[model samples]
Target: MGELFQEAILVSILAATVRIMTPLLFAAIGELVTQRAGIWNMGVEGTMLMGAFVAYIVVTAADSLVGAVLAALLAGALMGLLVAFMTVTLRVDHFVTGLGLNLLASGLTLFWFRSYIAGRPQPTFDGFENVALPGLSDIPYLGEILFTQRGLTYFAVLAVPLVWYFLYRTKYGLEVRCLGENPKALDVKGVNVAARQYCAVVFGSVMTGLGGGFLMLGFSDRFLAEVTAGRGWLAIVAIIAGNWMPKGVLLAVLVFAFLEALATHVQVIGVAVPHQVFLALPYLASILLMMGFKVRAGQPAALGVPYRRA
Candidate 1:
């Protein structure tokens, strides 16, 4: 009985870790692609928050999961478009543009949320449920840990390899990488540098939006202000700590997710330590991870530098 109970706890923790990883993975990997194309978007937190907010509204008002997802995507795309315009066209500092977006999103979402629920009970919806894959979900321990998960969780896991292939194997991928290294070279070859950066930024924001939607629909029944709770910041940290590689990002995300999962479970298991300590573990780990990782070899040389034609 004792052995079985311990095993169950282990499985539960691992499963939670995988689930928690979904949102962070989406945001981190997406940002990895954006950074590789020379744009350092700092508005991930706002983009994600907007996605989550739009999703919650659509889901509750229309009661349509599909609509909610689409709304989140649209919201993200809009944010991306603004980022591209400011950074690529207006030549605003990338950091400034991103931070401005974050502030706008924060203030805008809070006001909208307040108006949304005014004189009404907070809206709620049935979030995603686990989908247990047949044959795979039946396997002993691994099945419980890996096979039974929200559908988006599976997709998030697949995105890592898919993104890796896109970055390392495709022709366009090489051009995108070149944008980070030498946009002038691409321009000499007649490739449009600003256009490529626009596409990259939009793509990253779209994915981050999807991640935000997943974070909301998969984990919570209703929306709250700042619902992302700094996961966006953590995603940025993961990109830096992972050396901007997909595999490294995956490992980094797993560690952070595991810490978060441990925190969630610690409350259930009734550990004597303050719950706040467990809650702080992932952020604390982020600081340690950043301090420990010194490698910047994979970083794009021209990243965050506004492109100009000679």
Candidate 2:
């Protein structure tokens, strides 16, 4: 235990934890908004994969990080538009729509990757670099842990409070929340429920895309099939575990990220356990946490139910 707390190892783990949490934070916040609007978007994994694929392709071709990221955002929003059309406008089953999108994304990304890089060496590119805060970064352990990170990491952390305020303090947010609870009430009051839902789903998907883009641009040097690696699903879990609140979701993300960081370090620290066990730690923790904390009470009343005009 003492060895585990050594300054170097501890700092490494903490920094890794923050980096790991960034993507989840983005996706979870987006999903939180979508769910709050009464749309159960199960296609987040697919959306993220598509984003990663788009970002990678754009970055490789255009050699511009900004362009790649923008492409990724557009891809995510387009996917969200499809989801909204199917679920909101056409009244398709939300889960089925989401599952179908996931399949579509998986197949499409693989197809694109094969076609683009066929009979050639896999391409690689430099990702985002860590930026240390001025005076704050010079502080001791806390400074290294919090003040030194990729720009996206800082954005994700700051988004938590911003999202909380938006959800609890703004009119648009109140309308969004009402969409999940009593959409009919909003309709009665002349609010466009479907329009609001469309915005929420699109907004959530854009963030999810950004999360995927960050995964590729900030963490990995090259693109691979299914590069999202189930982070999208974990984001959904974080939302559920957090009880649909931004702060709660952030806490859940941190716990999961910590487990992941610990898993990586355990191998380095010469732990005698099977490597696979450490690899499974984060996932196992997720299952246990979900089992222990049931969030039915906090879930939106009309969640997963499509709104119909009376």
Candidate 3:
């Protein structure tokens, strides 16, 4: 272990962990917002997949990164639109609706991918250029990885504060949280419970889409079916594990990211550990985090139930 720590490979592994954590953080905070509004959105995976595909498609076509990202956001919001429609307008169960959306996203993206790319060697765009923060870019060791990540990385970092303030410091945020606890009570108070919930779902979904797009635009630059893999689910778990707080969620994502980093690092360092065992590190860490911690924290009172007018 001491010899492994001395290797330069550890630095690369740690940097990769930070890169992985950024999108997870984005998705976690987004889920936190939606859940706080009393809605459990399982469609994050779908939203992200859609966003990633759209972003890659656009980038590959127009060769414009900004356009691809914006389109990805809109595509994500559109997915959220579906979730909002079913859960809020049609008054379906949030969990059922969310699950349905996930299936739809998976199937739909696969359909499109098969049609467009013939399904093998999936389409890819060039990865984003790393943008270094002035002065900070020159710092030794930690500088390049932290300061020179892609544009989306910086945006995801900024989203932490923006989301934190929106949830804690805004009137709409309070109403959203209130609706989660008691939509009936919020309705009685003229809060337009459905409207607020719809906004929350859509907003959360847009972030999900952006997070997905970040996967392609920033890192992978490729559109493989279900390329998001299980990161979206991890995001949901991150929310639960973080107890729905921004800082807590960030920390949780870091833990998940670190495990992934460690697994890859062990392999690279040729640790006698089996490669498959190393691969299990991230998932094992998540299972441990989920199983070990009995995160008893304040949750929105009426979360997951659809509100109907009496």
Can you give the TM-score per candidate against the true fold? 0.97, 0.97, 0.93
In model 2, which runs have C-alpha deviations exceeding 4 angstroms? none
Give the clashing pairs for model 3: none
- Residues 1-310 of candidate 2 have per-residue lDDT tens digits of 4677888999999999999899889999988999999999999999999998999999998899999889989999999999999999998999999999999999999999999999999888888989999999999987889989998899999988988899999998888999999999999999989999999999999999999999899988898988887888889888888888898899999998998888888888877788789788778888987997875677999989999997
lDDT of 1 by residue, 39-66 (tens): 9999999999999999999999999999
For residue 118, give model 3's deviation from the true position in Å. Answer: 3.3
Error of 2 at 228 (Å): 1.4
CA lDDT, every model vs. true structure: 0.93, 0.91, 0.82
Better of 1 and 3 by TM-score: 1
Give the distance in Å from residue 50's predicted Cα in candidate 1 to where it truly belongs: 0.5
Question: Clashes in each model (backbone N, CA, C under 3 Å)?
Answer: 0, 0, 0
RMSD (Cα, Å) of candidate 2?
1.2
Error of 1 at 236 (Å): 0.7
Specify the poorest-scoring 10-residue window by lDDT in model 1.
1-10
Best-performing candidate as measured by lDDT: 1
